[model samples]
Target: MAELSENSSGYGGMKQVFTISLALFIIFLDGSIVNIALPSIIKEYSTDLGMASWIINAYVITVAVFLVFMGKIGDMLGRAKFYNIGLVMFMLSSFFCALSTNVEMLILFRFFQGISGAIVIPTSMGLVRTAVPPEKVGSAMGVWGAVGGLAIAIGPALGGVITEVSDWRWMFYINLPVITIALFLNKRIFQHLREKTQPLHFDVWGTITLSVTLFVLIYTVTKGPDVGWMSWPIIGGFTFSILGVGVFYWIEHKISYPLVDFELFTNKLYVVGLISNLLGGILLAGMMMILPILLTEAMEFTSLQAAYFITPLSAAMLITAPVTGRLIDRFGFFVPMIIGYIISVIGFYLLTSLELNTPTLSILWRIGVIGVGIAMIAVTSLTVSTVSVQSSQSSVASGIFAMVRNVGGAIGVSLFVSVIMTSFNHFSMVSIQDSIQQIHSTSLSTYEKSKLTDALKAQQVSFFDRNYTSHLESLEISKNNLGEWKKMISDLRDQEQKNKVTAIHYAFIFGMLLSIFFSISAMFLLKKSFRL
Candidate 1:
């Protein structure tokens, strides 16, 4: 036992590291892997885009809300104990998620899965800290991060294959085997690994305030485009989010044991990293949410084909992440991060050039560059942020950083969807209006003009509402030649399809601008000296 400390894997620490990493893998793997199946979900449930966003957002927001609190609780209780319990709950919830018959049920199950994830993620860091020797902590952390990167890289492609061959439900089914192995490995390592429990207060008020603030804010954004920005529910959501934030600040300052310690935020590098995380989250999450939709909708790619486009991004990220980690360890944080942001800006710029005519080969490089950019930012920001604070505050620091990233993802989903919906509506309306004007200037009889005008107006309303089948029914459009309106309807649809392509391109441009903004914010990190 005494000689065990001589090696980093004392008392099976190496196995523990992999076990903990397995937990991290499942949570992250589930997030990205499920993304490929989102459109399938929307079609199966016959739900709109906004509700489908919740299938992802519900999980993210729950994890963000509970992560810090769970970390504190793990410290007070036992990190190992909490992690094991979380594993069981996570597995159970995931199973239920596979059985979901409707979107609401799936979202509800995912929320519970998120809660379990909150417990597992932060505690895995703690478990590694306990099991590995002090000198080897950095290497253990690097390995943990590498596993996480691989999960992100593989998730989309794996999900694509699983969803394509079997149903999407099989994707969830796949987790059961992984979970079983993880649980068994955990038992072996944890039996010998001991923890030093501390007395820590879980700040309930702090948790509630911050959680409500993020939930309300994201909810408002998600509902705004569909419900009308100034509608009572949307307005009320914004109001609650604002008040929740104010209350959170007051609670954190007043509470004896705040969930998010105020001292950590004072470190300038840490704050910059947090901001960068938020912006980075927005850029990546928005890109992930919109790109697949654009592929399926505009480019007419099947789910599997769409997954291939994501392959380059994930593949580049997988290769670059560990290399970036080593680079940061050698040269410190700023240079690599700056270069990454620059590459990401260029990557996004290239994405804005996408059109129906762009070849798949061209798209791969554009996606791959962004992946390289993501790897650099991820390694540098995490290193700088965690190193900026004292050892005691490290867990809280990383937890906050991760939580904010999740919040940003939630915000990005809403923001991108909102933008796309609005942009598409504008373009669609313009196309319809132009076509209507063309009919007015035609040589048709007055009665013919009036009849076409009424039909066109009805079609415009149905298109605006996204009720395509209803509009087709009302117009009596059939595969066979129906009437004189056939050519006219075909023209309108062609114009609308063109409008959709343009609008999606606009969303890509929006992401590009945000990527540029993130790159600029990363510059702020160099202004301060980091602990490393």
Candidate 2:
């Protein structure tokens, strides 16, 4: 394939850049918007945490599995052709997602949506690199990258307004107009771009071996709290996931065309950059997971309110990341990464103040600081990953970076939800036990005390034994005194609400721990620009 020098078609080079950037923005915007809207979906569907999590995990895990596979297909086939297919597939899936009646259906469609996303990401980048001259490639990519960062920054707020102002379905629907415009421009822009098909070997065993393992593993982790961790379902998922990963590593090493070459881990920069990538996923996914719970469940903010409150963080990132990226070109990686992570750590520490009455302003600056920190880390780490390898192997860097980031996101969201739910359940049980003990010690008559104890036992036992809330109405108590038990039920509900507050607090802490670890690791990254 000949390089597309500074050749001008009907649309100039910048128009092509705009089309690709819009596509990137469309994908990233959906990712953040969905996070803001998740709590509504959970409340509306009456689904449990594990079930609701699949709304996120299903898309991320599927994307992670398909990214490299699709990238290879892009190389073997036509890049622009697959990219257009991705656009159509994503639009259709988005429409179907709006039509979903159940959580399962929504998640199923989102999985398809992710496959479309996997196709678009690498192809879009490849297309941009082809259309722009070598000197201008970085500038075009910067614009492409900036749109993504901006989308991430504003998605929460935008999704909130969409959910609050209209319906959550509108978030998916919103993409149609944007995609329509991008597709219209991209058709002409992509025409001038040439596809260089390569003779590539398919890593069949490696792809299957790994995808199955990750799916099972993530499924297990997400459901561990809902189903007992030790239950056959959970245990089986972990068993297979673990065994699958082990097999995947072996298969990749043995195959001629490995999915992930173990040999790359030998490079110091690659190793460090990977750590940052995985942590980046955990940070993004974990914060998105817990913040909704905080805003909607604990702080009693509407989706829109939470989105507005969090906008500053993204704004800070939008403003700072580009400048930080420039710093990586001048001062090298070490200073920027260290400064970024340090601010992020401070931001996380401030977030420990997340309680029912915590003011919105406190959250804004704290999260903003963390965002500023990430701005520095995100660009620097990408630079590090690409620089760690030969220029020829830069595509490998992109693949590995996407793989870790998505896989880590899937794991992070699952882990955060599991930890939060597990923590909340523990708190709920303890509160329940204390209430029962208080009842036992009350100076009521013997028969009265006995009746209350038995009734409480029946209620708790019924609640745990059955899956539905209808079980609460079926408790064994005097039918005549049903109204009298209303006070007790109210008390239980209050206790449950308090337990939720505590759970969200702990989830924030868990997220902070991830940020702190990532910040610390950023200190050791090579203090140099990428060779490319």
Candidate 3:
């Protein structure tokens, strides 16, 4: 392999950056685009919330677990070879995902799609480091980050329009064209830049232990609500996960070439950057997952309307990312990260005030605040992870950073969904029980009281079993009881809506607390005098 010049500059260098950035852009775009389509997917499959969530979780977990290993492979063999291969695999997986007829099939394909993404993301970052001169690496990273932000900006709206006019399947099909362009550009730019290959021992056991740890941990969190939280399976899953983590750590410490380099942990700057990235992912993914559901279910907005409302979050990110990159280059990551955290905390605080009747503009501005805050943290954290390491280790560092972020996203989606569902069920059941007690105190015949009580009791399981209104409509009521039944159903519906709003409000509160913790951690971890 020829040495890359420190003064490397020309059309070729710019083209290389653009090509790598475009590849990453699509990877991020895919993640955001699916949130808008989740409701439609659930309806089509008639799946419950737990099952519907797997559509996101399965992909995220697969990517998070495989990223480090794939990144190491790219370093050992050739990044360009794997990068191009990943593009092709991603395209094929997208096609299969579109063709899937069942939720199970879709999840399986999404898992494959995630594997391809793991290959592409780290390699793209590695390629960027190779393409640019050392002095201009920050600027090149700025362009990369900006493009990723742009992808997120358009993803929801694009998905909404596709799902509205065509089918949700079209969203998957749409990837084909974009990926084709990436493949073409990849071939043109990376052909001569391939690094010489070397044979190395792969850390297969370390990979397995780490994957098992994450999968079990995430699975337990996601399924705890459905099966009783104290059930044997959940208990066993947690025990296994804890043990797996210990084993994985031991294995990594013993290995010469570990999946994750433990040496990176010694770098305070790198560690803080990772912590910021993890927290950012949790907030960002949680917000994206819940907002669409809130809009469509609680506020009665169409998918397109919800997408339009959520656009500001990513739009703010797109606008802020480039500037954040430059700010990191000049003032270092500490200033931008601290400011970003404070802003995000405020955004989440405002989100806790959300009501069923909150106006669209109000929601827009709140999420927009979050977008700016997260963008600063996200861009800064990524730059820190890559540049803090030796250029030779850029791929591995990139992989570790991405792995933490995606793991946070998987956990966030699982945790938020569990919280909202459990809270909604608790609130709804209490309201129903109170309503039953009120009816019992009224002057009514024994038969009438018995009938009404049974109807309300049926609704105790309504949150998980079936639609509340549909279950009510299936009940038999006498002519004399029709008016009472209608009033009772209407009131229950109102209570259900209130319960959803309250549940979502609690999730925001959780996000706000996380932001505050992230802010405090950054302050303690990075000294006031430290820069970069």
Best by lDDT: 3
Per-residue accuracy of model 3 over 31-81 as CA lDDT, tens digit each: 777867887999999997678777877777788878888888887767778
Which prediction has the highest TM-score against the true structure? 3
Alpha-carbon deviation at 215 in model 1, angstroms: 2.5
lDDT of 2 by residue, 302-374 (tens): 6677677777767876777667656655666677767767776766667776666667677777777777766
Clashing pairs in 2: none
Off by over 4 Å in 1: 1-18, 35-55, 99-108, 126-156, 187-193, 461-488, 528-531
User: TM-score for each prediction?
Assistant: 0.86, 0.80, 0.88
Give Cα-based local distance difference scores for all models.
0.73, 0.70, 0.79
Q: Model 1 compared with the native: what TM-score?
A: 0.86
lDDT of 1 by residue, 119-139 (tens): 887777656654555444444
Model 2: lDDT of residue 494 = 64
lDDT of 2 at 406: 76
In candidate 1, where is summed lDDT lowest over 10 consecutive residues?
1-10
For model 3, the superposed segments whose C-alpha errors exceed 4 Å read 1-15, 35-55, 96-108, 133-139, 149-154, 191-196, 461-485
Worst 10 residues of 2 by lDDT: 460-469
Instruction: Give the clashing pairs for model 3.
Output: none
